[model samples]
Target: MREFDSYPTPEARERELADLVAKASATIPGTELIEYGRSVEHRPLHVVRVPSPAAGAVPRVLVCANTHGPEFIGNRVCVGMLAKLIEDPPPPLRRLHERAELWLAPCLNPDGYARTHALDGVGSLARLRHNHRGVDLNRNWPLPAGARRLPLPGAGSSTPGDATYRGPAPLSEPETAALDQLLTSQKFHASANLHSFMGTLFPPRVRTRADSLAYARLCEALRQAQPHTRYLRIASRVFDTFTGEQEDHQHHTHGCWSVCVECFSFRASLAQSFARRVPLFWRFNPRDPRPWVDNDVPAVAAFLLAALDLPPPVSPRASRTDP
Candidate 1:
């Protein structure tokens, strides 16, 4: 068995991620690193693009992780997926690469990620979830036209210090604005926002029956493609409230088949709960990340491939019904 330490420190993580991108680009044909935007702290935000082997305009897929600071396992899984794609892609990933252009953003919230590692498990978990200016990047996305924020639990908060604060306005933060620009320009056919510890796949809140069914089928593909343990597919129901989440924004505004992939497992969380003093970070990420990485990488590939197989959305600016 391989012995592993806790998650990497901020500086080490940045250096390692850059090195991984550089290596991938150097070894793999058509793989390039793009610096799309910078975070509030001036940390460069990058996406590693792996162009499809096929000719002409093909579908595009985006896999981004670590929007929240403490969920470091998502970053690991994204890196592992990229490595698998370049080194030895399985059937689904190979098919995906052959059919579509893939972009991997390993760490979306670098500022928040750095802050969490800097704390060294010393601060509140809520504080670790926000960016440098204390804004929740995941909840900072623009809502669909005419869709209002319903009064519901876990939707988001207006309070500055709260965990799910949605910032002053949509696209207010540099990180989210950068991602929005990327999504606008790329218009990906499918996207997966990697999160941790929930052990479920959450599809965006759909307004139409057709859209809901499409998401259900896409999530089922993700569930069936897992070689190891499978996660629950949590499809959004009609009455579900709209949170200013990235998946929702991607699906509604960009017409992308998007899902919030809650990696890790409730079983892992249960095990961590037995510890006398488990830090918030350990609760979200396992000690050895290999198992989860091995499990999720292929599932994500299958999900993206399945999305490409589905029919395209009605329109890029299609309006979704308000709750």
Candidate 2:
């Protein structure tokens, strides 16, 4: 019975998140708490808006985490970043605050998070990847035009019980639908969906050379801005297969610069592999999440600032075939 004392219980985390949002709303002049939608288990999906005081139209950035149940480190990063913004933002974060409106969706799959925590550090891997209705929210987005299902493994699955199960149809799950709605309404200039244990920044599927170059530049900015260990930039080449991921939908349909930040590290996974009886949750999340949070929170700010510096898109809504 390994005690995960370092990580907060699901109930405690929820309370802390609510408290943080309340504090920000009360203390920060332009902060707001928006309840976008409800989950399968009737849990409220919320986003905290920290609006910029910059005049005229400003860039907006969406930072979301915890799409996968067991990868709670991403959630920790979001909360920690929010705390920093509320208390004392560092140089990059302060610059981001001055230039962009930031929205934080700390836990996109709250039901799945609670379910994973209920396992108490012991469960099958399948239970740690899906929502209460067993759908992988990350894989439930709309696929881009000309993007076909590849024969490659880990692309995503159509099966219900599998880890990457994409659900019966695109945007079928309530969690994904709620996120899609937010993206549609907000029309963010840039976004980062946080995941864990890959230590890589994956851009959305690229269809053209120009798109690929743009993502490469954006990811390079993220890498250069990290105060600690930098994540590898796994930019999409021309032939990368579309996985109906949120980042792809954001980039293709909304013309937003979106990337999936896979936090923690593969090296950490290798180190944990030697431990006996390590639970599936522990494999995805570290026992102590502070270091990863410290490393990633600033990178999130850099991601937004880089996008804000880019030339404004000709149109906010892009066709599937548009680059």
Candidate 3:
């Protein structure tokens, strides 16, 4: 319904995604729509479920996007994959849907997402990174070892105004708490939190050899998803120890094999004509997310699908027993 290869505004995207999920639930055999919780601004947090009809215990894999609002490309990626599953799933993807329970939450931060669209001129770029309360949701999770507070020196900022502010406490914001509650309630074998404008794929900081091997296989699978698009692993020296990050928190608390996927660009670069035409905030996402959706949805979906075959995370007691 939208213009060919054009992106939707936040409001339009939300309605379309909800409609797509509703259609999938009505038409697709095993699809269902799930409302997990509400965002701080009271927007519904949605998860589109692609459940397996087969009898035995099927592993669950979650694909979530828009954790950081301005990075909206992943939202379309989720929609495209969900549509593919409903319409004409490829052989491998069909197999994935058959073998695993797939859950997709396309837009996790609606307030920030809307803020990106609501602002005029440079305001969008300036306010795109934080929620309405000015907290960076991605940087607001509890640290490893069940620590609630991130050390002030390395926690980005104690004040709420900064882009990377870790918030007054871990999971202080409603968006992060809703996500955390989802993890606590359901056991996901693996999860991928999608972001954009950094063109990197960062696997969680894994502890065991089994987890490492599983993570490596996932990395390779994602790389193979896009023929020319290179997916880089986040380096250990810097990104491995970011306090209160979602990937770190997911793995630390639930033993879920999680990854942070940054797509679209390695760095922010703009086409000469397009940059002059649109606001700076639009540049954070791909100029046209539709093309990226066609190229990367399968790859993103494949990463979640591939988790079904990977080694499950080590049990907490076993992990504790190891060195």
Kindly give the number of clashing pairs for every candidate: 0, 0, 0
User: Model 1, range 27-128, lDDT digits (tens) per residue?
Assistant: 667787889999999998989898887999998999999999889899999988888876787788889988999999999999888887767644786789
User: Model 2 misses residue 182 by how many Å?
Assistant: 0.9
Clashes of 2: 0
> TM-score for every candidate vs. truth?
0.94, 0.94, 0.86
What value does the lDDT take at residue 49 in candidate 1?
92
On a 0 to 1 TM-score scale, where does candidate 2 land against the true structure? 0.94
lDDT of each: 0.84, 0.82, 0.72
Which tens-of-lDDT digit does each residue in 182-226 have in candidate 3? 988887888888887667888866555667777788877877876
Per-residue C-alpha lDDT of model 2 across residues 1-323, encoded as one tens digit per residue: 22877677777887888888888877668787788999999998988898887888887889999998888889999888889988888777889988888899999999888888778756876777899989889888877755676756667788889888888888888998888888888889999999998899999877768777878888888888787788998764755788778888888778888999999888887687656677887777877888888888888888878888786433335334212
